[model samples]
Structure formats: structure tokens, C-alpha cells
Target: MRKVNEENERIKRRYLKYLKAAKRKDPSTVQKAADGILKFETSTNYASFKKFHIEQVIKFRDRLNEEISKTTGKPLSKSTIATILAANKGFIFWLADQAGYKQRVRHTDADYFNMDAKGQRVASAVRESPYPSLEMARHAFNYMPEVSEIDQRNKALFAFFMLTGARDGAVASLRLKHINLIDGCVYQDAREVKTKNSKTITTFFLPVDDEYLTCFIEWVTNLRTEKLFGPDDPLFPPAEINVIDGAFKVVGLKREIYKNANAIRQAIKEAFTRADLPAFTPHAFRKTLVKWADTHYPTRQAFKAFSQNIGHSSVITSVSAYCPISIEEQGELIKKKKKRNEDD
Candidate 1:
């Protein structure tokens, strides 16, 4: 029993390199493609790519349908199944164009890896997700206490997320120089900040001037004066973990930025939990900002800038991705239309 297929492994490495270097795919995307290919190979008992058959594709799909999700206590979602199939489908199609395996695997057979029409529709359908409202976000500020250095940092992290609508990755990686207190904006320099698609963006502070924004400003002031953090120092610096009493504890703040957004997410969870509210992931805050813009901004021109504030290149991109109309909102819109028509 072979644990690995050398030929398939070699091809997979080349494919992943192509995905990252040529296609400019992020590490996570490339890793997912590799995982999908591994799943297919494992199902066939690590069979050689040269001995591939179309029947194997059908068998894999059937097996996937039978698989139960550990999280939901039901079968895997249509979207998950579609993703798994799509990744394999792409790899199989690409594999067909390669030497040796080309003759054995027909490029047309890769179509068998595609999801059914029903599955496709289910995968494409958007489901409503919970997001924080402006009121709820403001309410959270009350829970944040600025007692210790770490406490102030956590409070500031929450305020910063709400103010900028920044992705957690960008938040974790921002430096002092990237922020402009006077201008009221964050410069997400892609060379340093971990922005999506490495896009450089400048996000202005949202029009919410309460304790939340004040807390963030105080922290910035403290960093500049009390802490004496230079322009290169992180805005929300990493926690200094110390082995006090032979046990690790977060004692203070480090001068360095976090390697990833996990700490920032933990802070959000803690803040929400303390506020007696359901935890919203950092990315969900962007949706909240978009929702805020939709109701508040009277003109399209204002809304366009609001969209740009969250790093959206186009207004349509912001509307299509973030501002999903709720069922209640949809009913209200329809009622308004009826009233207008009746009056006319």
C-alpha cells in the first residue's frame, strides 16, 4: 500500500507553483486546490494518474454526497461540495494538458467533476448573515475598559476596526505612520499591510464620533507621547507574553505588529462577549459599514466614496458583495413602490 504517488505529487507541486506564481493565487487558495487533488487521489487508493478513468470521477462525487459534515450533523453543503469538485475539475483539466497523463486522461472527462445544476444554484445563492449595527457597535464601546496597557490596546483595536472598516489582516499589520489622526484616515500600504489582493488603499474614519473613536484617538496619542512609538511601530502592537509563575500571561504590548489577525479576532470576540452580544467576525464589520452607508448616504456620489472607504474599487462591487437587502428591507421597498404607483 503506497502512502504517496511520486508522479502525482510532482505534478501537484508544479501545478501549485503555477497557481501561485503565474495565476498570482494566495497561499490559502493554492493550499485548497492541493487539498482537493489529495482527496481525489486518496479515494482511489493513491492510483497513478496514468491509470485514471472517468468512472472514478462519478464514484468520488457519489462518495462526497454520502459524506456527513462534522459541524452541521447533516450532509455537506452544496457550496462545499461544489468547491471540492471545482478544484479537482480544474486540476484534472490542467493535468490533461501535461505529458504522459495526457493520453490517459481526456480533458473532456474533467467536466464530470462539475456540480449538477441544482448544486450550482445552491452554491451561488447568498444567505443572510448577522452583522453589527452602528448602535450596537457604539454600545460595545461601553464594555471596553482602559485600565492596563493591554486593556487600552484591546479597546483601541475594537475602535479602529469599527472606524476604518479594515480587514483584520490589515488591522494587525498597520503601523503608526500609516495612520493620519489629523486627516482621519488609515493608509493600507500593501507593501506592509496584509490587504486583500495586495491592494493599497486609504480608508477614512467613518462619521461616528463617540467614545469608540475617542478611545482609539487616545491610544494613538499615548503611543506617540507616553509610549514614544516611532512612525514604524505598530498601531495595535502585539501582546508581550511572559512566563510569569511558570505560566504564560500577556503582560504588556510589544513594539511589533502581529503575524496574523488571530489576536485581533480574539479581542473582538472578548469585547462582544463582554457586551452581552453575539460575536461578529472582523470581516462582518465591513458589511456593517456598507449597510450603514446604504441608509445614511442620500446621494450615489456619497455612497461611492463610502464604498471606496472600505477599499472597494467600484460601488457595484461593494453593493453586490456586502449590502445584501434583508427580507424585511425588501418588503419595505416593495410597499414603498406600491404606494408610489397608487399615488401616481
Candidate 2:
């Protein structure tokens, strides 16, 4: 089998660059789109896309349903298939307008990459799960030991997530100057913070447990006052490792910020594990806050403010994404209503 089509590779690279620089999609998203294109390339034996026929593409789409997923050892889930197909759909649509490919690739040909109407509806359906409760977050934060500097930092990290509902990527990139204990908020500057859509948001301390809030404040204060960290210093700096007595030990904090969210995600998971709770990602805290606010916000204005505080420009984004009532909860609600009617 021919390993590479130089022409296809060049075009794929161009599409990926366009996705990143022009469309502002992140590298991870663009990579997945690349993967989908690669899958198509592999199946077609690196056939030149300029010679793409509707019949070949339609057969390829049918074969997609037959392909087994390595992760699950089954056919790809509806959603996964939709995502893979959609990537090709997007690419082909773009190819139709590109200089060399315009003569062959048609807008109508790209339309074949789409899943059937019913399949798309099924793929887009959202599944609900139990998000961590505020009480559980408080317990986990309190349960974390403060014996070591690393412990203290990890504790503060959890508390900050609970208070601000900031994404893990943004948390990893936070600077000492971004947080204000007196104002009880943090400034998530997208230019620095790796926020979704590069949004700059000011998130206030959510009215949760006081001790958890204190944990967040004390850690920030310790860095500023005792460690003498400048405004440029990392809020939760990367762990400093040193060889002590011929053994590697996590001695203290480094001045460097994490290049990614992996460390923060691992720390929070370990924190939850220690507390004997389900491992929730740092992003889960945002959902916890959103679920809580859904009940408290009586007016549309209040909801909008809450949404904007969490960096969402639209209120429905919060409501649709976070306010999912589970099937079990729905049944319980119905049962309670029935009981109330009988009592009355």
C-alpha cells in the first residue's frame, strides 16, 4: 500500500493551519480533525482527493459503521462516528473552494460526509451524570493535609476551583497577581490563562464553606508575603523535585507555571481519591456552581451575571450544558409529586 500521498498531505496541513490560525480552534481539536482525515486517507489507500467520487465516499461512509473502536472493542459510538465524519465534511466543504481542488471537489460531494438526520439527532443527545456536590468539594478540600508545601498548594488549588469555577487550563496558568483575597476573585486573562475562546473573566469567590475559602486565601497570601512571589510568579507553581539523602523528593514549589492542565488534574484526582470520593475533574466544580446557581437566580439578569462571571457570554450555554436533570432524579420528582397529591 502507498504510505503517503504528498498532495493530500500538503492540503491536510493547509486545512489544519487554517483551522488553528484562522478559525481559532485549538490544536487538540485540529488534531482530531486530522485524525479523521487520516482515517479516510488510510481506507482509500492514500487516493488523491482530487479524484474523489461520490460513490467511493458513500462506500467509505458505510464502512465507517463497520469499523470497530479500539477503546471500546465495538463499533464506534454514534457520537464518535458523527465527529469523524463531520471533520471530513468540514474539510471537503473547504476543499470545494480551494484553488486546485475546486475543479473536482463539489459542495454537493461534501454533503455526503454528513450522517443521516436520525443518526445526527442521536449523536447530539447529551448524557447526564451526577456532578460533584458543593458539600463533597468542601469535604475534599478540608480533608487535604496541610503538612507539606505541596499539600497546601493542592488544597488551595481545589478551593480555588470551588470558589471561582475556573477551568483547569486557566487554573494551571494563573499568576500570583491575578487573585485578590480582599475582593475575593481571580482575573482569568485569556492572553495568559488558556481560557476557552480566550475569554477574560473576573470570577468571584462563590459563597461556599468559609474554611475552604480560607484555604484559597492563605495559600495566595503565603506566596506573596512569605515566599515573596512577585505578581508574575505562578499561583500554583510546578512542583520542585530535588535529590535529598540519595532519594528524589518533592521539596517545594518551582517558579515555573504548568504548560498544561495535567498536573492540576492529577492533583485534584488524588485529592478526591484521598477523600474517598469519585474522582472529579477541575471542570466539575464549574458544573457544581452552575447547578447551585440555577436554583438561586430568580431573574434572567441574575442568571446572565452568573454566566458571565464563569466566562460564558450567553445564559443558555450554562442552562443547557449544566442544568441537566437525570432520569433517576426525574422519576424521584414525579414520585414526590404523586405523594403530595395523595396527601392533599
Candidate 3:
């Protein structure tokens, strides 16, 4: 019947602080660890961590496996389960080394939280995710209507993603000063823009269709001259909603930045829907750029430059994370190599 434990709460607070301060984990990552600990606590009915047992872990694993996701209305996925277990395992292992509870909890007890080999493999398996090709993106962009200001902004937003391969968060927080239209690059100043890991990235426009660059140029030009927006104003302003005929409608730009990337994502979805294409997330454009770079920039130096432009510190991270080879492409590459061998 107990809902909370004071002892557990004190320990959890210290643990979360350690994760943030010592481990240098981000706020979201720390929150996940907290959620994992809470799950274990709930399974044990708010029992003290000092009374931790391997049986508790077993029961928690079983419960998680049988758990259904409220959002998906389906059983929890292997990856999700694994992630939860890993978080708990990490916390328990750290707890074993902490003062006062060192005698009660053993480091080996944490091993019980791990999934079996097969489960781990299934959870970690790499699969190809959907992203638009350069040609497909161009086709979609061409179909985007540019009659109204909202339509123009939406169209330009899609093109901006393709042209710069900047992340949605950075795009949402960008100001007019961040973009260099003359140099065909975006200066993602972490102080102003919400860049990932607060990295200050300078991304040059990729050499795609001229239409993408042209569209973005017109939008920025209009923002500066026609709208009379200053450098401090939002590059892609949030929609200004007004009541017309007792109905709320997006009347025009608000001249303010989006608090998050949600609005940017909606704009992207609308653009793709209008173009009769799959509504890909703004991040998908990074994968598209990586895929294009794999074929276009064959040399190591050229590829490294391309990777750096997209905010990756190393080429390996860019290739391994984004540039997944399809089965069809893999087979064709092998066959081509065999043909070259035979010719020799």
C-alpha cells in the first residue's frame, strides 16, 4: 500500500545528480535512468533499495516483457525493454559501490538485469530507415505551392533541410543572422541555435538541385526586405494565429522562433503531404545527404569535409550511423567487383 519511500527518494536524488555531474549525462538521459529506477521501485511496491534481490529483477523483467505501451497499444518492444533493463542494471551496479549499501547489494546482482544474448541481439539489430532520395525530394519540392506567405515558408523550410542538412532543433532556433545566403552556408551558433550537444556547426549547402538553393534565397530575401525582419528575428517564424469568422486560422508569421522542432516537423509533414510523398522527419534529410555523399564524394578528404559540414566530428560516425547499404546495392557492388576480377 506504500506509494513512496523517503530513503529511496534521497538515494535516487544523489544518483541522478551523480549521473548528471560525474557521468556528464544530459537531462533526458538522467530522466531515463530515473524512470528505470521508478519502474523497479513500482515492481517491488516501493521497497527500500537496501532490500534489493535478484528475484526483484526477474519479476521486473517479466513484468516489462508483458507490459503494453499505452501509445502503441502493443506489447513493449525488445529494444524498449532492453533499454529499461540497462538503465536499472547501471544504477544497481553503481549502487553496489556506494556507501552504506555495499554489504546489502552485490555488483554481480546487477548482471541479473541484463537480457539474454538473443534478446540483446534482437534489440541492437540495425535496420534501414526511410529517407527521401535527392530526386524524390526535388519532385516533392516542385509540387509545393508558394502562393501565400505560409505556403512560401513551408516550401522554403523543406528546401532548407535538403540544402543545409541541418537538424530540426537547430533550424527551429535559427535567427536571420545564422544564415549566410551569400556564402551558401548556415552558422549554427550554439549560443543562439539549439544545436545537438550544443555544438557550433557551420554547414555549407550541399550540391543538390539549384531549385533548393533558389527557394531558400527568395525566402530569406523576403524576410529581410519585404517583412522588414531584423537579424535577431526568427529565420522561420512561428505562425500567427487569428480568429476569422469565429474560427482560429494561421493568419501570418509571428516573427518569433519555435520553442521546439514540433512546428518545423508539422510544416515538413504538410509539404510532403501536398507533394504526395511520405511525410519524412526533418532529420531524414541528414541521412539523404550522407547517402548522396557516399556516392558523390568518394575520396577520404572530400567525404570527411562533407561529414564535418553536417556536424559530425568524424567520418566514421556519419557513415556508420546514416549511410546504410541496401541489400540490392550490396549485391550489385559485389557483382561489379567480380566482373572487374574476371576482366583482369
Please provide, for model 2 over 118-174, each residue's C-alpha lDDT reduced to its tens digit, 9 standing for 90 to 100.
Answer: 988889999775568978877787788989999899988888887878899888888
Q: Rate the local accuracy (lDDT) of all candidates.
A: 0.88, 0.88, 0.90
User: Model 1 RMSD to the real structure?
Assistant: 1.8
Question: Which of the numbered candidates is closest to the native, going by highest lDDT?
Answer: 3
CA lDDT, candidate 3, residue 300: 98
For 133-209, candidate 1 gives per-residue lDDT tens digits of: 87787777677777889888888888888888899988988999998989888899999888989999999899765
Ranking by TM-score: 1, 2, 3
18 Cα displacement, candidate 3 (Å): 3.2
The RMSD of every model to the true structure, in order and in angstroms, is 1.8, 2.3, 2.4
Clashes of 3: 0
State residue 302's C-alpha deviation in candidate 2, in Å: 2.6
Tally clashing residue pairs in candidate 2.
0
Regions of model 2 farther than 4 Å from truth: 244-246, 332-344
On the 0 to 100 scale, the lDDT of residue 30 in model 3 is: 95
In angstroms, give how far residue 333 of model 3 lies from its true place: 2.2
